[model samples]
Target: MSAFSKALRTLSAMAIALAIGVAASFTPAHADPNATLDRIKSSGVLKVPVMVGEEPGYVKDPATGNWSGFYMDWANDIAGFLGVKVQPVETTWGNLAADFQANKIDIAFGLNPNPKRGLVVDYLSVPLFTDAWAIVTKKGYEKKTWAELNDPSVRIVVQKGGTMQVVAEAMTPKAQIIPVEDRPLGVMELQANRADVMILAIFDAVQVSKQIDGQIILPKPMLINPATIGVKREDGNEGYENWLTNWINYQRSLGLAQGKLHQTFEKAGIDLSMLPPEFSF
Candidate 1:
C-alpha cells in the first residue's frame, strides 16, 4: 500500500478505538445493572399510580377508598413478585408524565402508548393488550356512525392530556371537542346531556354505562391502541424496565392475560361485540 493510504488507515483505527473508549467510560466498570431493583427491594414499598377516575381498568372505590380494576390487579401482582407492599396512588389519564417527573410515583398502572407519550416515558416492549376506542352516547341518541359524529353541532367529550383528545379531534374535525380532567367527568357530561358523545375504550365506556342511566357505548370502534405499563424515561434503568417487561412475558406465558381480560369484562358487564380479538388471547 501507498504511504498515504497506510496513514489514513492508521488514523481511522485510532478514531474507532477512541469512540469505543468513550462509550465504555459512560457505563462505569462497577455500575450495577440492577440498581433500581435493589433500591425498591430495600424500600419495601412499590408506589403504583392508578387511574382513579377510569373504571373497569383502574378506579378507587368511593365507599372503601381502596383501588380495584384491571391495572390495579396487575400492579398488585407485580408487587407480589417484588415482595413489596403496594402503595396505590390516585392518578388520572393525564398527568402521568408530570407525576413521574416529580418522583411522586414509580409507575402508572394502565394506559396506551403513543409517539407523544413515548417521548416522555418508556413503555414495555411487550404490550399488555390492545384497547379499541368507540363512540359512547345516550341510549336514544341517533348519531351512530363515526361519520355522523363529524358535524360541528356534535359535542364530543374527551379526556384532556390523553390520547383520546387527539383521537377525538382527528375523528370529528368539525365537532366541538370538550376536554375534561378525568374520565368520570367526561361521562358526567354525557349523562347530563351537556355533551353529545365521548370517545373512549369499550372497557371504560362499559363501566361508565353502569353509572349512567341511559348512556351506551356503540359497536364499531374507530381507533385501536396498545396499552402497557410506563416508567419515567430517565428512570428506565435496566433493573426496573427489564423486570416489568419480563413480568409481562411471564404472565402471558401462564395465560393470565386472557383470563384477566375476561374477568374485567365480566366485572364491567361489557359484551364482546366490537372488542378486539387480541383481548381473548
Candidate 2:
C-alpha cells in the first residue's frame, strides 16, 4: 500500500474507536425499573419505612427486637404478594417527608395523605386506617374537646414538623404551643407537666396513656385523618405506586385491614373500646 493510504486507514480506525467510546459513555448507567413493583421484583425485596414509635396502631414491640405491629403486618402482606422480602427501615415522622423526597425509602407506613404532601410525594389510593386528634392531659385536667384545649392558659405539646403542629396551630391559636422533637417526647412533656395537654393521634395517645397516669379525652368533634402509604414521586416509580394503590385497595376491599387492626391491638394489649367509636380501619 502507499504510505498516504496506510496513514488514512490508521486514522479511520482511530475515529471509529473514539465514536464507539463516546456512544458507550452516553448510554444509561441503569435501566429504569419503571415502577416500584418492577424494582421490587428485580431486587427481591421491598424497602419500607417503619416510623419508630410506641403508637398502638403503628409500630411497637415489647419483645426482643422483633418488629411487629399493624402497619408492619400490612407491609409484610404487600411484600408477600409482590414475592419480595420485607425490609423495614426505622424512621421518624419528622424525617420521613425528607427521606421520601430523597428516595431513601420506598414506602412510608401509616402516612396521612394531605394535599401539601402530594406535592412532594405520591400517596396510595387506599387509606389503610383513620385516626383523630386526642387531647391527653393529667387525670383531672382532661379537656372535653379541642375547644377546651384552646384556652389561652392551656399549653399544648406537639411534635415538630408533624400534622399535629399544623392542626394545633390552626385550632388553638391562643394556646401556647410547644414543639417537641418527636411524638414520644411530646407525650413526655405532658407527663412531666411541662405542658397542659399533648395533641397526638388517638392510637398514640392511648398507648401513652397506658404507660403514664394520664387521661385521654377525645373531643366531641375529632380531627379525622386518613392514613395511607407514601411512595417516591419519580416517573420510574409511578408504576410501583399504581401497583401498590391497587394492591392496597384490594386488601381494603377484602376487609384485611380490620383483621390487621384487631391483631395489632391484641398484640399491644390495648382494648379497642378505649378508642373513639368513630376511629376505624
Candidate 3:
C-alpha cells in the first residue's frame, strides 16, 4: 500500500475509536434489575419507617417502647418473604421523602401519593387500601355537607403537610383552617372546642373520635384516596417493584390485606360498624 493511503487508514481508525469513546461517556448507566433485591438479601435487613400517634397504621407504646400496627404487620410479611429481618425507623409523615432520598428507609406503607413526592420516591401503582376523608366533630354540630363548612366561622383542623390539609384549603377556603403539626395536636384542638371540626381520613378520624368520644361524619362529596407503598427511587428496580406489586395483588385478591385492616381496627377498639355503610377499604 502507498504511504499516503496507509496514513489515511490509520487516521480513520483513530477517529472511529475517539467517537466511540465519546459516545460511551455520554451514555446513561442502568442499574441491575435485582439491584434492590440483591442488596436486601446481602444485608439481611429491610428497613421500614414507622410513624407514631396513628392507630391501625402505627402506634408506639409509651410503657414498652415497642411498636405495633398494620404497617408493622406489612413490614413483617415483606421481610419474611425476602428472608430478611425488619428494621423499624421512626419517622414523621413530612420526613418520608427526605428519608427515602437519604437512604434511611427502604419502604413506607400507607402513603397517599402526591405529585411533589412522586419526584423523589416511587409509589407502587397498587394501593394498600382506599381511604376517604371524614370530619370529626362535637356532638350536635350536625353539618353533613362540606359546603356548609365553607363559612368563615367554621374552624377546620388538619394535620399540616398532609393531604387533609390540602383538601381543607381547597374545599373550605373561607373557613378558618388550622393546620397542626401532628394528629394529637389536632385532636387536642377539637377537644378544647378551639376547632369546630378536624378533617382526617376515615381510619384516623374513627380512632380519634373513639379517643375523645366525638362523632364521625362523612361530609358530602366524599374525597376518596388510595394509600399505597412508597419506596426509594432507583434505576432498574422494576424487579423489586414488580414483585411487590404482585404480592399486593395476591394479598388483595385473597382479602388478606382487608382482613388485616379489620383486625387492626378491631385491635384499636374501633367497631367497623361505626364507619359509613357505603365505605369499603
Best of the candidates, TM-score: 3
lDDT for each residue of candidate 3 in 1-281, tens digit (9 for 90 to 100): 99999999999999999999999999988889889888887899999998778876887888998888989998999999999998989877777889999989988888886787789889999898898889999878889988999999999999888778878988999999998888899989998989999999888888998988889888988888898888889976778899999989988999999999888888777888889987889
Would you list the clashing residue pairs of candidate 2? 36-240
lDDT of 1 by residue, 226-266 (tens): 66788877632678898899888887788797679787777
Candidate 3 or 2, higher TM-score: 3
Task: Please identify model 2 stretches exceeding 4 Å from their true place.
Answer: 1-33, 57-64, 278-281
Q: Where in model 3 is the C-alpha error above 4 Å?
A: 1-3
Error of 3 at 91 (Å): 1.8
| Number of residue pairs clashing in candidate 3, backbone atoms closer than 3 angstroms, sequence gap of 3 or more or interchain | 0
Cα-based TM-score, every candidate: 0.80, 0.80, 0.93
Model 2 lDDT on a 0 to 1 scale: 0.76
lDDT by residue (107-186, candidate 2, tens digit) is: 87777755666777887776877777787778887578767777889899988877788888989888999998877787
Clashing pairs in 3: none
The root-mean-square deviation over C-alpha atoms between each candidate and the true structure, in angstroms, is: 6.0, 6.0, 1.7
Error of 1 at 134 (Å): 1.0
